[model samples]
Target: MSNKTILITGCSSGIGRVTAKYFQTKGWNVVATVRSNPEAQTELNTLENVLVTGLDVTNENSVSTAISEAIERFGRIDVLLNNAGYGSYGVLEATPEQVIRKQFDVNVIGTLLVTRNVLPYMRRQKSGLIINISSMGGKISFPLGSLYHGSKFAVEGMSEALSFELETIGAGVKIIEPGMINTNFAETVGAAFNVDPTQTEYVAFVSKVMEGLETANSNHSEPILVAETIYEAATDGKRQLRYIAGADAEKIIAARKQLNDDDYMMLIKQNMGL
Candidate 1:
């Protein structure tokens, strides 16, 4: 059994839950966090060498308490996977201020909060890996994805710069930029649409844009693909910065590299039929 340990957030379901289970099966200790403790979590509750804690990353108290609990149980933490995030897709002008704030809070600020708390433990060990879960959307943007894409772009930039700072301390930083993965996150995004009936001026255009988005997401990789990538990111022992997950994710990112801004935007619009 590898004595190595990984601390992951947002484990109630989706990528977080799958990643937690993946590490446990690999003989690594796992600390999985959910927003609140339920009576039971069938998938994660039964796993061995795993600790489930309540953590609301946006809240300082929740973040610190979870870190303390994990350290107390495991003695040390080897990896910190900031996998807690959600998307709120909608028209920019119509989207509520609180909703946009919450989106950034969970995706960007929450990532920093969790990382800030775990850095001390990893620094003390003098060796660690921090993998922030970004998305292909981070590099490529689409209509109604402005809010979601902005947060991911922020994370992508943050991880890149932080890698330089952590290298001197023997700790490493990596980003898992996953494409469309089958998860509840898609359902959440679908539901975040808050259309304004009075503001029907943009309705027809928005509908077309959404149709294009649906086409873009028609084929998505399973969450395990991303979980496996996360596993590789943790164990690879290399300073690789961005590990792209899905096949579409790879293709899109490669295209992004070859195309300039205008071309990329045109390609995205064409692909999505916008």
Candidate 2:
């Protein structure tokens, strides 16, 4: 237990940062990665039993180097937490094709590449876990966030299929569907929007939705809650596939399940005053 290691991506902040620290607290070796320079990972750098490194998931060299470095340091990795992802905001029509490509590159392709790299080791060792950090957004869509939802939906689908395949090798794969958490996600998503300034037709609709999202953010749950759920998913020996991280996540997922697609979409539009 004390020597167990978990390699997590996107450890710069939010759920990734918290989960890395949380696992370290339980006496496990933690390999945490940030896209920025390793010297900038102040908090993680100071922690004992934690290895802070640079990893840009969308970059092939960075991803391979991170995994190699983690294994070289710890000897083995017991869990791989795919916590690196961001929301791509704006209407689909307004979003550039390059933005869509980058969005999927990080959220979907990065996840695939990392998992592929880790599986060989896990398969040889006959044990491992992969916890993908998804969102309620993955299951439920919203106005003007088509790209974000698309990436998450891709994550969910891939994780689902990989779970069955990995289980054969004594490994596990699970999804963490977190609701809006208190994080820099809002600011990041705001700055990440690829909307064209001249696209005034979607302006009003996007603004209303953004306002509602801001209100939601103000009331969002703590990131530590999602981290705790990540822990649950890792340690829970049962072959469960998905663990909803917050009360709101559970509520929204349940609501979506109870309503038809058209009804859910209509309700969402009404909430944004469309």
Candidate 3:
């Protein structure tokens, strides 16, 4: 049994929800937050040592309020998990500017905002961890995944830089790069199809990529695996900055490291049947 506290975002379902329950079961105070409709979260609300709240990571006021509430309830925050992100896949030319901006706003800016808001408390405490839930997409790219991949790549960069500065303050930063967790997040990734039908060439390419993704997604790792990995990163007491969670992610990232850029690009094209 432990008395530490963890604040997680995007707990409406999937990884965030499972992680909240997992930590609570381990006797950690869990602050579970959603973008909206916090009142309807009966399951987490009923759990002991859990605070169910509303936190739109993109909103500064919402971010501040959630942090204040967490500190008030738990006296301190030991871990902050920036897990509130959705994938929007579309070609750069076909994706509307607003959609592209929104993707960065949620996936990149939201992570930054939440992390900034929590840093003060963590710095004051002099010992805390910030875990950003990136994806294998951060390291590699796919067709029509420009929006999603760009944002995740930005997170990867930001986390790496932040990790260096945070170490001096006795705080650590960890990035979880999961390949494909069996969650509705895949549907969210595939739902954004902006390829113009009139552009027959782009449309054909997009179709093939989506088809390949559908087959790849059929074998997804469970969300618990990711949650368990997050727990390890939090307690492992190592200087490791990135934790690859899924088997697929491990293999793919390993291959990415071994191959040169041209070879990797060719492999990606072949995999997508391009």
Candidate 4:
């Protein structure tokens, strides 16, 4: 990994932050992006091989500028990690159009914009990796998370298509599907929905579901696990389109493959105490 340039988004916290540090420790030239985090910047700036920048994935200008700056600094981008996304927990009926659009903007369109900016450089080099951080939610939907699930599902579909498109081109595309990891993700998501009081009809149910997510996240795998998975996907010789990071993600993917939609919903409802 030494001397290789890897650019990662959403590096202020959670899996992205960990992955950036991990790659730097392995001697990679890391361009770590954050929306806003003074502490993260201060820490990463102290590192010899890291260049931390402010990046809002939903903004085309910000994404383009970040990628361009990274290229200018590092000469080329060897790996592009699309890990910037937030979860919006709400029933489809209760979720507003704005909320849905925001979710898609960050998760789906943001990924596309960043990838588009970075691909030309990769094509010129004729060797690069594009890794998208999806979730078990990408494959299986759960109650009170329709908007979030929808965004990840888009990621899953887009990644598959992009994998086929990039295969013959020398570049590669991979999806990292991780289940509930011990991070501030759930709290952040809960906060997103909590502020929207207009969806009062499903408040009770949504609250219960959010509680369950908090509990599940407590015993979840560490962010380092996902970081390691990203590293493998970026550097591994074999071309694997999807890599399930945690045991829970593997189980969920298996269940999604085996069960019918109705059966899966029944199981999800039962788990959520719905």
In candidate 2, what are the lDDT values of residues 182-250, reduced to their tens digit?
999988888877777688887787788888787777768999999899888888787889999888889
Q: Provide the TM-score for each candidate, comma-separated.
A: 0.97, 0.96, 0.98, 0.93
Candidate 4, residues 1-274: lDDT per residue as tens digits? 3799999999888999899999999999999999876355778889887888878888889888888889889899999999999888866775678888888999999999999988888888888999999998899877777788889999999989988778766999999999889888877876677335686777788777877776667668999999999988877877778999999888888988999988988887888788
Error of model 1, residue 202, in angstroms: 1.1
Model 3 TM-score is 0.98
lDDT of 3 by residue, 1-274 (tens): 9899999999999999999999999999999999999989999999999999999988999999999999999999999999999788866777788888889999999999999999988888899999999999999887778788999999999999999999877899999999889999877765766777776767777888888888778878999999999999988999899999899999899999999999999998898898
Report the lDDT of model 2 for residue 81.
96
Runs with alpha carbons beyond 4 Å of true place in candidate 1: none
Question: After TM-score superposition, what is the CA distance of residue 58 in candidate 2 from its true location, in Å?
Answer: 1.4
Task: State which candidate, 2 or 4, has the greater TM-score.
Answer: 2
Cand. 2 Cα-lDDT: 0.89
Using lDDT, give the best candidate's number.
3
Per-model CA lDDT versus the true structure: 0.89, 0.89, 0.91, 0.86
The TM-score measured for candidate 4 stands at 0.93
Which scores better on TM-score, 1 or 4? 1
